[model samples]
Target: MAVLTLVLLLAGLVLGALTAGAAPDKQAIVGSALGLEGKLGAAIAKAPAGAGAGQIDSSAPRGFLGIPGAPQVNPILAFLWAVWVGWIFSTVGAFGGIMAGVGHMTIFGLGDYAKSFKKTAPELNKVLTDCIRMANQWLVGLSSAISSLNYLRSKRLAWPLGLALGAGSLFGAVVIPIMTGGKISFSQYQGWFGVAVFVVGGFLLYETTPKGQAGKKAAKAAAQAFEKSVKEGGESAQGIAVKKWGLTRIEFSFFGVEFGFNPFWAFIGGVLIAAISSFLGVGGGFLYVPYLTSIVGLPMFVVAGTSALAVLLSMVTSIASYLNFAGAAVDWALIGVELVGIFIGSMVGPRTQKYIPDIWLKRLFVVLALYVGLGYFSKGFFGQSWVPM
Candidate 1:
């Protein structure tokens, strides 16, 4: 029954994608017939064909902003990209959604296409932006679910802390879509996204320095123990045990190293992070990573799993709000194929992460955050990207 259901779902995704591609303008016509104005339908009617002034093509491709020959995405590239996204997020417990955004906006040319409609059809541009945000959450949402379960199996996840954070995130996640959805332009979104990633990258980079490392004795000790367990091939040395749980504090031990955090502060952090993430259309793993390591003082070994749990909770609410209240739409074919890849990559990340050093995991995050942040920020605000896609 499970296999049959899965097969049916896949079939539906394929059919949906095919239908959208075959008759791209059908949805627009229906919207017009139903008296639903503004957004994509209006964009199609208003957008210029680029051939001459006032030229319009009602049958424009979805992401091309009425340019008939704008490049179609290569499904293979998208699938491969999604695989990478899943792995990174599952392994590091952050940045999966940001990377997914990069692929959707930059690699697939959707960003340029969406931005093109900003002046001609501001409503349409915002709608496309919302879709991009919605799509990013979808990939992250699935990756987070898989990563959480895998980490739980290994006893690396901090369930109590995650639950507290998730509780706070629920409120923020639901509120952001209602406030910002259908209002933000693609370029504005990109600029802010870049700024956020860049700022987090800087903070994390500082954490890697000797001065920053001075205070993180617990994290280093926990990391060493985890690495030793990996080398010795013993389950005895690997697992997280709850030491105490209270309204004010939550404590856990990993490989005999104790870590604790204030549950109240964690909940507050969750609310703020979820608001930022939902607005930016990300999983908030990047933010959670820093919070766990610096504020919560957990070692990298446990941070990934814990971050995944919070992300899963926040993403669920954010995606639901976008689809239900914001009127966002997604390309089922693209999302469907990418989801398959995300699952494969997510499954492999936890198993492979045990082999990598804790410090290296953080270093990886820094590199990606810096690079992605700089490129997107410059492109969005300056009208030209400093880095090549």
Candidate 2:
């Protein structure tokens, strides 16, 4: 089923790219439909540049879109690239997923088993569970912090950024497993890393505030005052109450599948995930996992599985957007190398999860979070160029 979905998604992207230019004014029409005006309209008015801008020519390849001046790679080559990249990402995602799952199982499942089995060493089970829970949260938080810093410093925060970051992280996750031969230690750096990430993220946020922008302090203050007033008003009284008690949720449907999202807050959560995911190079699964667990009151297991599932949707949308607009050529050989690395990493990642103690897991997560945060903060404060590859 997963394979079929991926195939269909790729096909749709190719078709969309080929036919993007069928109507020269399609983007204009779309902008008008969306009720955009002026500069916004102009921004949206541009079609996918390059080969995505030409008319469909039958004389071209059967599935080809006649994009003028577009660099066209052979279909066979593109297919191979897709396969390689897809496999690589899948492997990375799978490995992360498996490790996360094991951590969760340790926390909840093992604890349950200890009670049910009436084991002589049941107390050890509780300690292990706690460690895993802590590690999971810490790692997630660290990743989030890093992602946030990256986003704040970036001139442009787009979905492609997130995709690339995801790709990179996937590579890292897979590589670590291979280098260690599945004996990667979560204990060595989880907690400190998380602290570093948080620090970096906080610094980036501080540096990017409107106060830091030239001559914007007064305006920023005024805006904040206005917002505060609105929040304190009678109209906002009920709204605030509702916010406190209400379940904040976001629902969207794609490819005939209905997905639900919520985590303490809606807009902030969405923006954070979108921005950070783009910046950090992972599908934002780490952030989502924590949010779902801490705020939405979901089980750790559910969060891990659901986040992994959501990534597939994100990847498809990203690939489709790239194909439809940029029409970049895929490098199949390079993609193949990535895939091999990913597959090996994913298969081995889960095994490590089973061995790590829960307390240690939590500490590891914290360390990673801190590291990411610090990295971002430094970039923002120092004006360092921290571009993702």
TM-score of each: 0.67, 0.30
Per-residue lDDT for 386 in model 2?
Answer: 40
Any idea how many clashes model 1 has? 0
Model 1 lDDT tens row, 1-389: 99999999999999989987795442222123122233445444444444322233434453332234344778898889988877876786556667788898888988887787777567767887888887877776655555566765666778888888888788789888898888888988999989978876777787787777875877788989988888545456657889998989888888888888888888888899999989887767767887889788888878878887788788888888887777776677888888887877888898888999767877888998888898899988887888875
Give me the candidate number with maximum lDDT.
Answer: 1
Q: Which runs in model 1 stand beyond 4 Å of their true positions?
A: 1-56, 60-71, 83-97, 152-163, 203-263, 298-309, 340-371, 386-389
> Best TM-score goes to which candidate?
1
Residue 113 accuracy (lDDT) in model 1: 70
Residue 80 of model 1 has an lDDT of: 92
Task: Residues 223-318, candidate 2: write the lDDT tens digits.
Answer: 888888885434321100111222454443322333344433433454455443322223456565666567755444334444443344333333
lDDT of 1 at 43: 45
